[model samples]
Target: MRNVKLIIEYDGTKYNGWQRLGNTDNTIQAKLEGVLSKMTGENIEIIGSGRTDAGVHAYHQIANFKTHSMMSVYEMRDYCNQYLPQDIVVKEAVEVEERFHARYNATSKKYLYRIWTGRIPTVFHRKYTYYIPQRLNVEAMRKAASYLIGEHDFQAFSSVKSKKKSTVRKIYAIDIHKEDSELNILFHGNGFLHNMVRIIAGTLIEVGLGKMKAEEIPEILEGKIRAQAGITAPAQGLFLYEVHYGE
Candidate 1:
């Protein structure tokens, strides 16, 4: 048996997210599995690092699948790219350790949220960036993000539907890059809960807009309630930028 690891990139605008839902075939995982199963003549399953919400793009999403097929990794990559939809591409594929599991073995993940802070619409970036036609106080947003750069119980930033034993997670870094009207917020964390990053981004945006004070982040976190956090930023603005694993 061979454990094949795949690096995938996709424009998630029309898909229903990354996980495969029962009776719903519009998912990234289902799409890749269908092609791989056909190519290998065996039922195959791909374990993704995490489930990205609908309309959330990915720059380098990772997945691993085990199969008993004889096809070379290069051939599998080519075949998948040739057969998969134009919006989704298998950038790289290679064999990995037999015991490797994509989701469980992941070490860290980096997500990027793109925002357009301009009075006019960002014509070409509309699909990938959230448009807020107002000047954002970047420095204030930075102050709010500093509170999120360490281990904490992030229950308030998670979705109400998110049920986890412990909502505690560690954030290694929070980087904000501004180039003209484009603001890129990148977060490096051990793991994330449902709608966690989006909620964080929304909260920071509120601080930037003067609706929320940067000093209130700790209180919101301590509240441990969803209502205390800001809105869930639109999925289109969020991207699974990268996934890290132990070598």
Candidate 2:
């Protein structure tokens, strides 16, 4: 058997997230598996790098599955795209070593959150960004972001419903950039808890809105209390930007 790694991109608006659910009629994984079974004549299981929440988009999500087919990478890509739905596309496909497990071998993940800080929302961007009419203090937000740049117990920033035993994760970088009326926050981390990025975005937004002091970020981190942080931002504004692995 040969392992095939796939680079996938999806809109994620209508599906029930990446994992295949028992009763769910729509899912990215299920769709991919369906197409793969049709193309390769085998019941294949596609393992994703990570799960993106419902309504969260992905630019370069990665997955790998074992198959015995002799199809070329280009042919597999084209065949999968033909059978897959319009919103989901296989960007690339390549054979990899049998030891390459998509989830366990992921070295880093990059996420992007988009914010629209204009008075009138742009029709074209309404689906991808969170529109906030109130003015934001960008400098304050930057200061708050600095406190979350290292390894720490991120219980305050994570969803209480997360089942993970450990909340300790290393954040490699957190960057806030602005262009025109759009504000983008990029997060590069070793791993993340459920809704961690969205909550961090919400807390930063509170700081930017002058509702919270930037200096309070450390206290919030130390507190490890979810209520001490700001609200969780909508998942629609977040994207699984990329996944990285060392050669």
Per-candidate TM-scores read 0.98, 0.97
The global C-alpha lDDT for each of the candidates, from Candidate 1 onward, is 0.94, 0.93
Error of 2 at 175 (Å): 0.6
Instruction: Note the residue pairs that clash in candidate 1.
Output: none
Candidate 1 minimal-lDDT segment of 10 residues:
158-167
Off by over 4 Å in 2: 160-164
Compose the digit string of candidate 2's lDDT tens values, residues 125-220: 887999998989998999999999989999999985655588999999999998889999999999999899999999999999999999999999
TM-score (C-alpha) between model 2 and the true structure = 0.97
Poorest stretch of ten by lDDT in candidate 2: 159-168
Clashes of each: 0, 0
Clashes of 1: 0
